[model samples]
Target chain A: MESNQNENKLYILFFLVLSVILLFLSSQMSWLRNYISYVYTNTSHDQVVNGRQVKNYFTLFSEIIEIKNENEKLRDENSTLKSQLDTISFLIEENTQLKKSERFLAKKSKYSEVNMFMGEGLEIGYIDLGSDNGVKKGGVVQYGQYYVGFIDSLDRSSGTVKLPYNRSSFIQVSVIKPTNIEGLNTDQLKRLVSEKTKSKAVAIGKGDWVSVENISTDKGVADGDFVITNDPKIGSYLVLGRIKDLDRDPASSSITSSIEISVNYYDLNRYIIEIQ
Target chain B: MSEVIITIFGIFLMPILSPFFYGFLGINVTALFSLLVLRYSHNLWVYITIFILSLLNDVTFHLLFGSTFISIYVSYIFDIIIKRVIPNETRTLDLIFTTISFFLFYVSLEIFMNLSSGSGFRAFENFQELASSLLYSFIMSSVLLLISMFRTYFSGGTGHKIIKL
Candidate 1:
């Protein structure tokens, strides 16, 4: 009975000792935590495997169904193509006539010998095709029929084209009125332009938007009047935004009108830089 | 001749295999296999093997340098802890310990890499990627343990005798 009691005590002591060691080892060895994470991950992976197999089976079945639908679509397309083949020669003749008319119209207009590679956005990197490619610094870059920006710096292979949307960029623009308005004098217009320059108009804050400031109500500058860059070297009148707001300057009694300029980056994305 | 060939193979193959397996299936099979191998042969040779295999893994995988170094070293620390603490050397206990060790190794590696790269604690931001990594580590370690058991059974030897705590 005494030996049995001693054995029981020894077993309890052994358990306590083992527990202490395990706790100490776990505290010191940081990898034990990682091992727990590993097990957890393994169990999760197994769960996912089971889940994904079911999902994949359904996805594959759906894909087969889609293929059948696509096959029917192709059959319809094939029959339509066959039907169109008879009219192909007649369409080709008409297409050639259209091409001739387009060419005639293109020949009559002035075409600039410039090519541009547009960037994805305002922050995109610029590459210059160089002066050898008729690209130079200070050259204007135009998107489909509107001025976007100009070349700021040039390299042998590429140039840095600065977008007009940059805050630092400033260009002189001409404010032209419709031919129907003849009563507005040039002095009145000059005063209007001067007042516009002085007023703190939000419209002219960035290159993306500009405002023509302080025109008199009598000068008759309508919403549709073209405001264009005054650079004769550019050789083309670019359409700036329509006048959105007309307001008189309260601080200046002489300032009577303001025209807000709109510049859209979307329209400017297609422009090629014209090398100066 | 065989020993020399195996040593060279381990040196060259571990790194290439680690990332390839990790990337393809999210498991570092080679690292786990190396750990199991090292379990039997706890000596200078084993440490050397671990170091070389880890170096190979680091170089071939384009992972940050010193990552494998730190991971294997930490794994060695865990091996010591397991040996010192677990008196019974039961397979279940070994598995549990190894899993925990593997997780800690991954966490340490991320911390070490972040410190070395100076990236601001961005590791946890990609929880899915981290989860996949942990899953791969567990799979690799489990397979390695199973293979070690199979190896012992087939050889009619207990493999490396577990050192008593």
Candidate 2:
């Protein structure tokens, strides 16, 4: 009788121990909880293993079918976007050549050729191409026809091109209009025009931007006037943006104003960088 | 000479063996293999041996230090608890308890690291993976238990009896 009672006691202890273990495991292992949840939700379920949770085996097959259908839909959308981008790039290159010929006919100075090399990834993207390559600091960088940024740091093999849209980039520019004005000396106007051509400016923010400061407003600057870098080294005018804001200080002897300039970094794949 | 040879072999072999590589087969199976291969006589000695082994495992593999220590300690706790409750330990109990204990140990460690680092840890991400790991450990531990039983049976004569408690 005592041995039988002890056997019964041992069985009870075994059950208690197993229950405690399962409780502990369920709390700790998310998989165990998921299995329990799956089992509880599927009332007719019997066994739950790692790979196959068989709820009468029929339902498991249905779940696999649904997942395969979703996968096919994502792949089709990915291919469509890639084709559209390819067509857009081809048109932009053709248009830039036409504009280049128009500028040459107008007797405007030619844009400088800026070579750009794509890097592996962002982490080590700043590796320079080579020492022999003419890439230098303060040289402008562009993606396609639109201005991207400038070379901030360079090594023997690579350089870090600081994007104009990057929070840190800033440059000085001047606004120019279509009609030439009187009383502005030809040399002084030329100097101002040259300076406005490829000069540097700091990036304050990004959006559809216009107008920039540190340029004289008394030169008959208006809302639609074109601003470009004022650096004399880069002789050609790179269209920045249009003036959206103009605040003239009337009391000051020297005219000081703020003008918005235009350059959309996102619209182009390549940039026209000016070597300084 | 045998003891020295075993000790030297353990020292040479441990760093080369990795839980990650073994965990591909299953975390539990790898863990059970580690426990069986590194088994010692005394409880204190077992804990210390496992701790050192785990540390060596961590350093060689470039894993987070003390991870193996946490795993081993949790297993040791479960071993003690099972030994106390089931005086005559069955193979099934051993398998179930070790699997549960190992699972809990990994889950707790992951949770603690995630909370402390403020990022979610990805040790065993899915339910299927966890289930496989548990099964692997159970099977491996059972194999080890069977081997141990066989060794005992062969080593003793007909007059010798197996200890129940």
Candidate 3:
């Protein structure tokens, strides 16, 4: 019995030593680590890992058909709006004087539209762009005029966009408190924040919704304010969501007293990745 | 065969549940695997499996090298000793041991990570985050233990051998 106990101890010692060696080797070897991550991501079907339902090809095909119909309707509306906009461009440009500004004239970032929805989670989707297309790891993704997601991971052929609703997705954002106007236009709001005080806060993803945290209650952040990304790489004050409510009291004496706000994003299919 | 299946299941399940316990920083659910191995598997295979799973977790989550591996291995050894001392491991004993071992795993791993991180390690800044994460983890572990106890009672003590064999 004593001999058996001694052997067990020896076995444990050997395993422990082996594990330490493996750990050291793994840390040093980037290829080994990358391969493991690649395999894990590949094997991990989207919605399955995130507890979202996996849709069959038939359901997907039907959804595609529905989207196609909606696209045509939007296309007709866009064309009609474009003709009307052309007639009023001179008047609008004269009023805002934004057309003269280089910042206003230049596009903030290049976009890669949604190619496919990959994986189990609705938030984790795939785009057609790759490293060759300059799609980077931290590149911001957008849906229409709103900030939605960022590039989670990517390879040579494809990339993953972690939507605003993902649990680990954290983005720095600043709330827009309209001072002089009831509802300011995007251009006006951008110029205002850029010219004046732009205090940034962090927003964390929570599945279907988002929550802004670490915001000092003393910042005078109120309800119905708009949240926009502070990512310089994106270089645009694209609205992310509206602040539905506040968590902390502005009257609280505690220095650690911080407020949280709810965030909502557009549906997954409308997302576009900003590539450089 | 059964052990391999269970270990694989655990590796897949732990990461999914971990983000829920996450506070300012992520909660250390790799400790849960260590706890599971301690409670079950009298042999060395479970420990070995846990080591591999912990390695996979560290790599996937971009944790520091040997941080989680060493912390969990130490916790496994700690649990072994605790099991011996508290021979009749009741629900209360299980909760107590889990809190002790979980905190042990967290502190040891965090220290190791901080040490490895060099200038990036902010001890005072991270203290609140770690504390909040620890509290959340404790609550989650308590709920899990309660569920296990309930399952054992409902199954007519068949599940009671979770700590023994």
Candidate 4:
């Protein structure tokens, strides 16, 4: 009984202290945390379960389960592909407008002249065109007319572009209300256009949401109005996202109310990084 | 050997089940882990294994480093205190201990995040989510523990009936 009196207390104290130190060090150096995550994921690729390797489970029942999961995955892929096809067709027209301008396209005749690089999210990407193909850092990456991202770092074979949804993305924006008004009076149309076009707002991306911190509370901005980038490089109006909702703080009679807009980054499959 | 098995089991199973409990508030597997550690393991390495399990969870969930481990450690300490205070094994005590353990873990995590990132409005929103998740976790953990007890009883262990408080 004396021998069995929990000697584990010493072990617990040691580990607890070690963990606290590691935590403090990791908080100061985020890269260390990232390195730990990288190591963990790589090491646990073939984890064991019930005395058997997880990857080695190839029984008939397991196969059926695998097939079911694969089916669901395929269904998701199908929907994503369908949406990409729709976006591609929409981009084709925009490409045509770009080609007409001698300055925008330069020597390139078609939009497809610039190679496409598909990215998983705002962070990592694989560009088909790299440094060898005139792809350089500090370049504008556009998906058709809309400036989606900019090339940050590049490799000899490929480049990485930071997309709009990333926290670092900042874009100057203006609102436009697109409608079917083929026969509206000139005076009414001009007045409507003037009212809709207000002071430019800076939109900062926060993951899936983009927030406009300064928009007039009384501005006749409504849901479904298209937000466009005010970048001068691309002379044409490019759509960013639609205004989703707005909230005002009642306590402070501030002139501007914060607006939250939704921008779906899912359907983007292709991008054109303008060489610096 | 059993310790190793439980460690592996916790590491693999917790991440899979976490998402089901995590929506409004993040319901982690740390509370369940501490409870299991208390029930089955006698070695000090068992706690270390649980801590490592939480670190693995942080990596898998893309959370800040040391967040899960710190929260789980706080919960583990809470478990130790409850165990020391009331060593009796009863359904009421188990439920109370589990509730307190989970609550402490969540509060510790919230404090860490708030202090680390100065997450002001986000912290308030997260607290609301935490409240909802706390109820979900308490019900789930208690029911699962009771089920395990019943299973043990049916398998021919010396069974104790639930007593009125």
In model 3, pairs of residues that clash are A46-A119, A46-A120, A46-A121, A47-A119, A47-A120, A47-A121, A48-A120
Segments of candidate 1 deviating more than 4 angstroms: A1-276, B1-5, B43-46, B60-64, B120-123, B158-165
Interface-residue RMSD per candidate? 14.6, 16.7, 6.4, 8.7
Q: Please list the Cα RMSD from the true structure of every candidate, rounded to 1 decimal place.
A: 24.7, 23.1, 33.5, 31.0
The runs of at least 3 residues in candidate 2 whose Cα sits more than 4 Å from the true structure, single-residue gaps closed, are: A1-130, A142-150, A162-172, A178-211, A214-217, A254-261, A273-276, B1-165
lDDT, residue A217, model 3? 59
Native contacts present in candidate 4, fraction: 0.20
Per-residue error for A113 in candidate 3, Å, reads 74
**lDDT score, candidate 2, position B33:** 40
Give the TM-score (vs. native) of candidate 1. Answer: 0.35
For model 4, how does the per-residue alpha-carbon lDDT over A1-276 read when each residue is reduced to its tens digit? 555454666666676776677667655666765776676654433332321332344365788998999999999999999999987886886465444432333343233345444565544445666777777676666654445666668888777766656677777767657553333332443445456675466677676556664555556666666566665443334456666665556564332323333323454445555554
Candidate 1 differs from the real structure by a C-alpha RMSD in angstroms, to one decimal, of 24.7
- What is the C-alpha DockQ of each candidate? 0.02, 0.02, 0.09, 0.09
TM-score of 3: 0.40
Per-residue lDDT of model 3, residues B1-165, tens digit only? 256765675666654544323321245555775666556443466556666667666665566655677777666777789889987887777877777777777766666666556645433246686786467558646755865666566666864645543
Please give, for residues A1-276, the per-residue lDDT of candidate 1 as tens digits. Answer: 787557645643454344345433533544644553453445434444655565677689889999999999999999899879846754565455334323222233332334345565552226547766767677666533345567777777777666544555555555565322123232443444444322221223254344555444445555665454444455444434445555555565433233343445432222344443
- Cα lDDT tens digits, model 4, B1-165, are 277776676666654444333431334545566556655566655766677676766665555557677777777788787789888858777776777777777776666566556564233355576876577558746764775576566555565534322
lDDT of 2 at B109: 47
